[model samples]
Target: MPDLLETVIENRWMVQPNHANNLDTAHGGNVMKWMDEAGAMSAMHFTGETCVTAHMDEVNFKQPIPVGDIALVKSYVYRAGEHSVRVRTRVFRENPGKTETELTTESYMIFVAIDEDRNTTSVPELTVGSERGERLREEALSDAP
Candidate 1:
């Protein structure tokens, strides 16, 4: 079994001019790319197999992260089927000088485990190893619209 908490991942990236658009904010595509990478890591951690994205929910961009801000991406596996992992991923904007962060984007992503031959494989059964893990799973489930 794979512990859901153990598969949670958080990463930070500094937004630079290259990642911004004419409005001087992080491009939507770049933000999604970061989310995908983080989500894939969570899925791989839970499956212990090579995983590729199967689908992604429509992304809702609520805020813009300015070029000087830092993008904080967090991803975690909340549920799993026989061969697919469901991950909840969220991105936030963090100003370098402030501790608070604002939600910028959120979406759910599905990843399928695959072998070297690209055949789908079984994913480890998911288990909540701690109270926190269970709470996160509930949160993810309840937040779906």
Candidate 2:
């Protein structure tokens, strides 16, 4: 089994003008798109097969990403079942020097692996093979303020 930390994926996207809404901030839809993509990447890393989103537990937008800012999205598999993997994703804004990071959004997504025929397939048990993996899993389960 691969360690969740090793399987963690990070995706960065520039908040482009076209991706913004009338408010000049990144559109909520664009943010959700990036989150889903990042989460799917993490799920595929853990399952080693194509995975589809079964559910999105919650998505809270606590802050807005501006056009000149960069959105850094990180995702990792925190828990896995027979055919499902629960992934936690966090999005942050990156600005040089300032080094400020705000948890703009977070989501807990469930994905199920699928075979070539598009049938759900069982995935291997997840193991926190490293201290970092264990820490990430613990963080994922922690209550959000």
Candidate 3:
């Protein structure tokens, strides 16, 4: 079994002119693509198999990340079913040299493990190895609809 925390993934993207919209803020589509990729990574890491995104829950753009800011995407697997992994993904706006980050977008995504044949396959059970892992799982569960 893989610990839930072991599946956590964090990636950062600098919001540049190409990623910006007319308002000079990060485009919604770009943000969504980043989130989806991060969530898929988490799921694949946990399952030890190729994962394909099956569904995405309600996603809200809470704030706009302006150009020159960094889009920090974080994702972790919180739950797993027979062949599916549920991941919670969040995007934050971070400025260089700043210790604090602001929430920009959030969503829950589900991915199905896939075998070499591209057929859905079973996934191993997820475990919480430490207090932080337990807490993270709880927090995601509480946030669920």
Candidate closest to the true structure, highest TM-score? 3
The most accurate candidate by lDDT is 3
Give one digit per residue, the lDDT tens place, for model 1 in 31-124. Answer: 9999999999999999999999999999999999999999999999999999999999999999998999999999999999999999999998
> How high is each candidate's TM-score?
0.98, 0.94, 0.99
Which segments of model 3 are wrong by more than 4 Å? none
lDDT of 3 by residue, 82-142 (tens): 9999999999999988989999999999999999999999999999999999999999999
Score residue 138 of candidate 2 by CA lDDT: 91
Q: Global lDDT of each model?
A: 0.96, 0.88, 0.97
| CA deviation > 4 Å runs, candidate 2 | 96-98
* Residue pairs in clash, model 2: none
Full ranking by lDDT: 3, 1, 2
Over the full model, what C-alpha lDDT does candidate 3 score relative to the true structure? 0.97
Worst 10 residues of 1 by lDDT: 136-145
TM-score of model 2 (CA atoms): 0.94
Estimate, for each residue in 1-145, the C-alpha lDDT of model 2 and write its tens digit: 8678866999988888998999898999999999999999999998999999999877889999988888989999988899999999889987745777777988899999999999999998888877888889999878432
